[model samples]
Target: MRELYVKSLPLQDVIANLAEAFETTYFISCHEYRINVPEGYGSGFIRGINFSSGFGLIEYSCTFKESIKIHFSVNKIHPLKFIYCSEGIIKHRFEEKDSLHLIDQFQNVVVASTAQNGHILLFPSGQKIHMNSLEIARKDFKTKIDCDLHYVDKNLRKLFRDLNARNLFYYHGNYSLAMSECIDEIKNNTLLGFTRRLFLEGKANEILSLQINDFEDDQKAEPKRQILRKVEMTQIQKAAQILKSELANPLTIKDLATRVGTNPTKLQEGFRFTFGATVNNYLNKLRLEYARDQLMIGDLNISEIATNIGINNKSYFSRLFKSTYHLNPKDFSKQISKNVLLEKL
Candidate 1:
C-alpha cells in the first residue's frame, strides 16, 4: 500500500498532537510516558519510557479505519530509531526522492541518527496494524556503555558538524524470536493499575534491547556474505525453513543441503548470506526461542522442556538459556506469572 509523506517529526515529539481524534489514556511516571488511545480513530495505544541509562522506548500498536499521514518533523539531531513490524504493513522514507521502504510481517528497520529530517508513516484505510517503534538516544547509551556496542557509535553520527561524512544510515533484517515473544506479551498482558503499566514498560524495554543484541550477534557471525543466484537463494531459504520447522530433530549441515538440493559448503555459505548467521547458530537461536515460547505457555517444567528439545542435560539447557536470555529457565517462568489480568477499556 502507498503512503503519503506529509511533514513528519521523530515520533517522540509528535505525541502532544497525535490526531486529536482519539480518546487517549495517558500516564507519565518517573520513567514512562504511557498512553492508550482506544477511541475516535479506531483502537490502539502508544507506550513510551525514558530510562535512567539514557536510552528510551516508544511502542505503537493501532488499527485504523481512516487514512492519515502523521508527520515527524525533525527539528534536532534524531537518535537511532528501530521500527519492527509483526503484522500489517508500513511504508517509511527519509526524504522525498528516496524510495519508500516497506516493513511487512516479521521484518524491522533501523534509522541511524542523522541531520534533522522529516519522516512519515501512513495508516492506510481498513488496515489492522500491529507494530513496535523504539527510539534509542545514542548519546545517552554511549555515556553508560563502556563496552563497544558493535557499530552503534560509528553508524550513528552527528553529521551536522562533520560535513565530510555521509548523513544517512539504515539497517533492515528479520525480526528475532525474542522480539516477537515480547511483542506478544505486551499485546496480551492483562495487568492493571501500576502493575499493568510497569509490566508493559518493562516488556517494551526488552523488545528494544533484544533487537540491538540480535543485530550485533548477526554482525559478528556473518560479515561480507557472498552473492548468490536467485535459484540458490531460494534453495538456501528452503534449508532455513527446514531448520525452523524441524527444531527437535537436529539435522546435520550435509543432511539439510541434501534435502534442499545443495552441498554443505553452499548451505553454510547461503545460510550466512540469507540470515547473517551460519546454520548451526541460526538453529541454536531458534531452538532457544522455541524453549522460551514453551516456558511462556507454562505447561512444562525446565527439565521436561529441555528433553522435549532433545537436550538431555537440564543443567546444560539452563546455561544455554541463561546465556541468551539473561535469565535462567526458572527465573523466566516466574517473570511471567498467570495471575496478572489484562486491562480493558
Candidate 2:
C-alpha cells in the first residue's frame, strides 16, 4: 500500500540494461530488434528499431509484481524526447524539478530538458505497463542529410538552435487515434530484408509527422470551454466507444449525451476535446471508412455494402461515399479490382 522508487539509468541505456538485468535475450536482425523477458518475475517484451540515422523507437509492455523507478539521464545531443504510453501510469521528474508530473494512459509528453543528466521514471507495482518511446536525436535532426523536422512543434525545433537556453520543458497531452494506430502498424509490420529497414525508417518518420500534425490540428480545432473533470473526460471517452461499437443503429448526440449522464453541449464539447472531432463528424468518418474497407474485401455489391453500414438508401450511401473518397462505392470497388488485376499481371 506504500510507494517506492525502484531503478534508474541513462535514457539510452534503458533497453540494453533491461536485457542485461533481467534474463531477457536481446535479439537483432535486419528486420527488427527486441528483448523478450519470459513469463514470471515481471514478464514483458520490448521491441523496436534502432535506425542508424539517429532516431529510435521502443515499444514495451510489462507487468511487475513490485513497484519500479527508472532514473535516467539525457545529454545535450538528443535533448528532446517524445514519449507515449498507450496503457499504464508514467510519472517523470527532472533533477531540478520540485515535483513529479504524471502522464496517464493514452497520453504523451514531449520532453525538452537542460543539459543536466538527471531524470526519474516511476511506475507502480501490480499495474500493467504498455508504452512506446520515440526518441529523437537533436544533433541528427539539425542536419538536412540526417533528417528533417520542419513540421515538428516549435519547441522541438528549438533543440536545433545553438543557444545557451537549456531549460527543462515538458508538453503533455492525449495521443490521438491516428498516432496510436500508426504505432500499432509499426509494431505489426511484417516486411523483411532491406524493405523492413526502409519500412522502419518510414514509420519512424511517420510517427513524428502524425504526432506533430495532429497536435497542431487539435490546437486549432479545440474549443475554448472550461476544462472537464477527470470523471467527465472518462465519461466522454466511454461514450465514444459506445458510438464506435453500436454503429448498426446510430444515436443522436442528445441521446448519446443523455446515456452518459451529461448535457448535450458538454457532451459535444468533451467529445471533440477528447477525440479531436465533433460527435457527428467522428461517426460519419468511422462509418465511411468501415464501408470503404468492406468494399475492398467483402463479397457484396454496392447496395449490399450500403445496407451493411446501416444506410437503408443506396443512392444516399453512394453520395456519401463519393463525397468522402471522390468515388462512389461501386467505382471504388472497381478501382481496387483494377489495381489487383495489375498486380497479378
Candidate 3:
C-alpha cells in the first residue's frame, strides 16, 4: 500500500495519467473542474495501479474560481467518499446520466459504492476518504480485534450523520464559543488514523449499548404520558417562538403563560413536556444562539450584544457564555478569527 500525494496538476492531466497507470478500462475523476482523458494512454499518459493501504483512499483537493468535472467508469470498484465543503459550493454528478448532487458550503455528501453502479465520482471543494478494506486488512494483521464490526456498521453511519448534522447546524446557525470549540474538535480531531478506524468500528456498538440501557430504563419507568391537546401544543410552540424572537427582552414564565392564555405552572409544565427543558433553559439557549451569531459575524461588541440579549450583568454574561460554550466571549471571538486565518491559508 502506498500513499500518493499529487498537487498543482491540472485535473485532466491527473486523470489521464491515473487511468493509464492503473491499467483500468476507465478512471473516475471526482474533482471541481472539467477534465477530459484521451484514449489509448501512452508515455506521460496516466496509467498505473497500486494497492491501497485501506479499503479505500482519502484524497483532498481545492479549487478557486473555476468549476471542474470528474470522470469515472461504470465498472470500476467504488470506494465510499466523504466530501466536505469548506468554502465554495460544489455540484456533483454521479454518472453521466444522474441528476447532480449540489453540496453547499460547510455541508458534506457521503457517497457509498452500494448506491452507485460499482463506481462513485465526486466533485468537491475538499474531501477525505476512509478506504475501509485497506484499513481493516492493515489492522486485522497487526492487532487482535476486540469489538464487533457488524454491530458498529449498523449504527456508524447514522451516528456520523447525527454528529455531522449537529456540528453543521451549530456552525451555520451560530452558537457560543463553547459550542464552537466542541464543533472544531469534532471536525478536525474526532477521526484520525487508529482512532477513526476504532470509531468506525465501535460507534455503533456504543450506540446500541446506550439504546439498550435507555430501553431498560423505559421498561422500568412509570408510564405517565402527558397528552397535550392540540391547543396546548399550539400554545407551547407559540411560547417557544416568542421566546426565540424576543431574547433581548425581559421575559418571565408568567408573561409567556399570559401570552399563551395559560397559567404559569401549566405553561411551564407544557413547555417542559414538549421541549424536554424548562422555559428558562430554552430561553438561555436562544440567548446563547443570538450571542454566537454576533460573535461569528463580528458585527457587535460582546458586551453590547450581551446587553441587547438581556444580559445586564457583563460578568455574569461572560460566565454564562463560558459555561454554555466552554469558551468565554473573548476567547471564542479570537478563535473565530483563527478559523478565518486557517481558511485563508
Best by TM-score: 2
Ranking by lDDT: 2, 1, 3
Which residue runs does candidate 2 get wrong by more than 4 Å? Answer: 1-14, 38-40, 74-79, 145-153, 160-165, 218-221, 224-345
Relative to the unseen true structure, what is the C-alpha lDDT of residue 290 in candidate 3, on a scale of 0 to 100? 90
Which candidate order results from sorting by TM-score in descending order? Answer: 2, 1, 3
Cα lDDT tens digits, model 1, 49-69, are 555544556667777667656
The top-ranked prediction according to lDDT is 2
In model 3, the runs with Cα more than 4 Å from the true position are 1-230
lDDT of each: 0.66, 0.69, 0.47
TM-score of 2: 0.60
Shift in Å, residue 196, candidate 2: 3.3
**Model 3 lDDT, residue 101, Cα:** 66
TM-score of 3: 0.35
Please state every model's RMSD to the true fold in angstroms: 14.3, 11.3, 16.7
What tens digits encode model 3's per-residue C-alpha lDDT throughout 9-35? 223344444444434434442321122
Answer with 1 or 2, whichever has the higher TM-score.
2
